[model samples]
Target: METCSLPRRKLAAPLLALLTTLSLPTPASSAEIHSYTLPQQAYSGSRERHYKVYVPSAMTTPAPMVMALHGCKQTNDDVLNDWGMKAAADRYGFILVAPFITSYDGLRNENCWGFWFEQHIHQGAGEVEDLHQIAQQVDAAYSIDPNRRFITGLSSGGAMSMAAAVAHNDYWAAAAPASGLPYSEDSSSVSLSGQCPGSATFHAVSQVVSDLTGEVDNGYPIPLLLLQNKNDCTVLQTAANNMRDAHLQVFGSGDFKTAATTKASDTSCSPYNQNNYSCHRIAYTQDGTTATRSLVETIFYDGPLTTPNAQDTDHGHYWVGGAEGNNGKWALQIGPSYPDIIWDFFSRHSRNGSQPQGHPVIVLQGDNPLTAELNSAFSDPGATANDLEDGSLNVSADCSAVNTQAAGSYSCLYSATDSDNNSTTATRVVNVVDSNSPVASCQKISASPYAHIGAGRAYVGGVSSLRAYANGDNVDIGGSFDTWSSVALYEGETGKWYSQLPAACSGTGGGFVCQNWNTTNLNHVTAGRAYYGYYTVGGNQYLGSLPGVNSWVKETASGYFQAGQCSN
Candidate 1:
């Protein structure tokens, strides 16, 4: 991540030139906007407050709610008209709430939310309390889905949205703070005057949410989708980065993991840690056992407003341009459609509980064999199963078609089912071949880069040993062909062999010994069972067999490693 330093030179000249040529559009007549005044007592330390609600015609019972807060000098109507959020509400079938902040003497900008004030930012106080009360009022009046409620804001409003999310994580399922600051206690003063204060230190998301929700150990994490403009001058890009890191810390506990990110011509979708969180704590569940999942997504757009005839290099601080008065200001020039992206992220999550399926894990006892000796008795090695929520599971193996008397490749099927009936399958392969002497082929007699085994190895105290091996005539003697050599193990019981272990060999000789070769853990190996070993070199494989000394083997030894039983 390269730091974006504000270009000190030629910054104001280009901005002034761009603003001079800009033309504001006339307000469009909108019938969806409805005005409502909150009771004076609803918000203390503030005068009469008015809020507007936009209920889309397509809204049905129990629809999601989106609270949009406007920036300084921007009105609810400006945000509704300019931000182009109403179309999203109509498309997504969610109720839109836009509130207005009347003039105040100490305000740096006209009609700005008091995001800097401690009372407004604090939980259950001033504007924060007012917003909560208004949400409750809206819930009482309309069929708003309490589990699917959301909030977003631009600039100061963006900062306020962060405050709201942090102070009241219980109310909002997710928050999208567009070009806003993460709420911090150190900054005593906040303004929309284009001069941001120094960056403030913040707590981890887990700690903050736990403190706010009073569930120190098991609090539900509020999902966040932070939107930023690389060229945002009003709210520095650093502020956006700080906010993102802060939220990721909250959701990821300082180890934020990115799940997937897609970059299109005009839009980029970077969803973080997908399918990971089972939001059981905040989920609204009817069965008391099921829960839904949540995710955190972040998006950063490049320079210039997407609107036509807009400046290509300027601070994108305004809502997206389709509003009558926008005049192509404060929009991204080459990035995802902001409104659509926001609605898409908001629609994917809900506190309404939905059961999540947990997949079971299957562990095979033996490795897939590259080759098996003919006329050998085959037995099922079996497997173990475990599930996240269902605990231990019953695993079954079927090797009915294995014919060790003939030389051919075969597969054994293994399946497992959990208590919830969720099942998974694993396959092990076996190869039987005629007794053929392994050819002694050594391209270069150099020390194997990997670990190797010793002949007739002994395990003291009845402990099992796991080993790795690799051999190939073309195996790089210079230690560069680390990926070329491999080993496989054949389970006598299942007649199945597992071949996933890579060879890490060391020792300079035609028969270089390898260690760390076992595919399955030594603990999982069956006691008193003989497991056959096979090594591959340059596409040619050598099977271990007793009384079959060839150029590849100077001594005809046991073709298998016998596991010793340990007394308890």
Candidate 2:
């Protein structure tokens, strides 16, 4: 909820530095570029174009597909050049497919997704059809799980993504639109008992639900992911919030306020509580004009999930899987690892095509390097409030004890007391390192003094690599053959830390250069620990390390925000 408008001095310094380094790679390089050419003229009248896809080797199975749509006046390559989806795909196996939208307003490649409800030469339905055909073509060629298909966009493309989802109920499993106009039509009010005819009839939000999954069945419903930032000027965050409540209602969830808080809550959902969907909303602000200031929020609804979002500080457009450019701002603004969370949701829920196993279970991510000690007084519910409420316990590992074979990995035994003082025992194998594990010590660097793009706009970069001192006989690091990477946020005001990289990046195949962003090379750090990792944004790549608290001071902005060594 805090807005970080980039200061003019800070902006100018970074921009100047970027101008000098635009053609050179920073000494701490973390990522490389991977490009993909679009199907060559699969259809006549098609434009000769190629899309750059970032696929991380961390992906094991053929991951889900995220189709990122570009905004008006933006080319697919430009979007790809900006979002850094390739880094996310490389960190996780999910496939990223970004489609190019041709420019219609005299700007080449500036045209947005075919306007469904907007004034345009192409009907929104036609645009949706074209997207569907492209997805079909890609699915046939690759091992994409169609059931886990997702779509997202920004500005015109953002609104278009929503409209496309509405038009093709059978195609996208879920959709998220950042800084775009709200649904031009009310979709929740319609009763989806019968066939939906005409665009107007399908406009209602509720009708979208029924059309996607036949029969308007309440017991089984598709999930919807919603990400909105407060204080957003382009597309009002408030509208996105309203849409969340509306979509929940369409899912047949009732309004129920929490006992402790006055805010209305819903029970029909998990991860993001039924009523407290706002809790999952990620908000941040920066300097710059309309194109640069906007941030992104990724939502995953419906079912069939995989690894959640992955984190990287890449300023490129491939920040989030298939979604790139303006969409990447929305993706990375929420920190680096969000794509992994999105993919996790896709892989876990897509295969079944039905509801999840039970109440949303919070599985602990096991990427931290330290080891955690379980409370000897463990019960059937484990320990702490989260356990009592959600049947899970999230405890930080002891950083000093990390690196042992047992580092970030521990076993816990639990016993329960019955009404008559009876006892039962339960054993659990806790994987402190959720995805790939973290390395012990590494030479870390950061973009503390990030470069500024313009008013309210700035770019940050950092990197981390294995340190010889941290990897000795004392450590047992054998999770993945590839190295891992991560990035964190230090509150400019509070001097606290926010875990930025959720998943580690690794390589699919080492080529002329090494690409390591996975468990073997890098591992997850404890929630409140300092670390480093590789970050990629579009064509720009850098190695960033976590800075100590209060590393930045609000000086006259003549120099970079200098930070000190992080401490406990």
Candidate 3:
């Protein structure tokens, strides 16, 4: 319901859900730059606002919008150009809105986003509220995609972006705060607001969110890509660390899980620095869900130093690595392609409830992890499809690609479409596996139970300890007793093979005495693979398998049988 234009949002879309690979029609961009202004509020000394918008050349209808906020002493025009965001806009087809700060205290003569002002910190009040209104007005003019709206900025711009996200958490799809500070109880105080490593002074993301939207919870946790330059002098690494901790204080506990990736070291990135400042990415996502709505991902770029912004003396502080990347001011050119990264992260998410969902449904009619005997003929179980607009639909299954003659996993993809060209696809894995093979050996031995022996050993289940060694070997099992378990020294009358112990074995290990007729002899057998049991006579021994799936040593081998091959 919290959309760019609530009137045309959900009702405008047909029953077509967003396709995994959507083929949306491209719209011609107006290529016109437009500017707007909003008179300051009745507040004592609030200044009027100025902002600009640029629609990409080949933008998508209801396109996404990115609010490019500038750092201290920098104007919106500088951010749109010097940060290489305008070029990104041209390439990605999103509406770019650059917000300029007009208010200046008596002391400071530089343009800066008022992230720490008491009025700006709260939603629907000051500078932050003005930025929000600009977003709404841009959508009113261009019909922007409500689900894809985004906000990102440099130093102070970044801090303001964080505030904007918390204040209007339901409005933005994602926010990337570069070298920005987290919300603090002392954020209103200019001196204390500059404190780093919010561990001691920062407020929990939940707390500020609660403060901003009291009794109005959207339940949509804002996804964030916290950016930092490891070599940044203006904003120390502690600030980034504290920012991370504050978000984690709320997202770290429950369904969210943390995963890490190492940085890539490339020496050919920027002329300024000769080291690869590949992003050290730490992503946190909810359990059972991936590819979208990330709780937080902290990226540390340790690249070469570059020119500083006019307001500060910090290098490696700007957005890095774009086709037209700017390193003149608060920009770094050697690190990761931030534009592409931001777009990719932004594309994965949308406002939680804003997604239109009358899409056609196609559900496969069979077991998910299905299986067939090795080299056996298989048939597609097929699927049923239905749509809200088109009603019941004919479903087509692409099962010709499934090769049952080969052992391993294949998929049967089922797809369906509504009258409106809205379509969906479903897939089921068809695992072809080998039938259980016998674990026969050369001779019979102990009858005592050994816990180490597992499945596939079941292939020779019909054979008993009392049975003579008939493995094509002429050796006769010498039993002066009634049975191997009941009586004597189980030695072979013909061969010297015998049990190492005088006790009786009751389970599958009893078959180990027989010769193992395997692939070396016949071509119908499959190799057992990937760990079921570590059989050691005493302790610590050797074992082998194929790898990936097929734990033939397990008792329930048929159930977990996957990722295996059947061939000579």
lDDT of each candidate versus the true structure: 0.50, 0.36, 0.55
* Regions more than 4 Å wrong, model 2: 1-52, 58-62, 78-84, 105-111, 116-125, 185-221, 249-337, 354-398, 401-568
**Model 2 worst lDDT window (10 residues):** 449-458
Off by over 4 Å in 3: 1-30, 43-46, 105-109, 185-217, 251-276, 288-290, 308-315, 353-568
Order the candidates by lDDT, highest first — what do you get? 3, 1, 2
lDDT of 3: 0.55
Identify the candidate with maximal lDDT.
3
Question: Of the candidates numbered 1 and 2, which has the greater lDDT value?
Answer: 1
Model 2 agreement with the true structure over 1-568: per-residue lDDT tens digits: 1111111122344232212111211112233333333323333323333343334444433446787777655566645555655554553445677777542322222365544333321222245545665565445434566567777676567766766665564566766665444455332222223321201132344543343334222342344444433323333444454444344444432332111121222222122211122324331111111221112223422211111223321211222332221222323322323344444444333423532211122322221122334332222223211221122333332223223243355455444443333333433454443224322111122222121111111222222322211111112122221234322222221221222211221121211111122221112221211122322221112224432112211111111111222221
- Using TM-score as the measure, what is the rank order of every candidate, best first? 3, 1, 2
lDDT of 3 by residue, 1-568 (tens): 0112112223322211111121222234346565666556554435677777766776656677898788876787777666666766765567888878866554332776767666676666777667776677566566688888999887788888988887788688889888787753343322222322222245555564445445224567778877787776555566666565555544444534233321112122211122236656666655524433567777677754433233334344566644456544566544465665566556556675343334565544444556878777797766767553455689978877778788788888888877778778878788887655332222343332111011111111223543333222323333212232321122222223233421222343432232222221001112322211222121112233221212222111121221212211
* Structural similarity to truth (TM-score) of each candidate: 0.46, 0.41, 0.51
The lowest-lDDT stretch of 10 consecutive residues in candidate 1 is 272-281
- Evaluate residue 79 in candidate 1 and report its C-alpha lDDT on the 0 to 100 scale: 73
TM-score of 1: 0.46
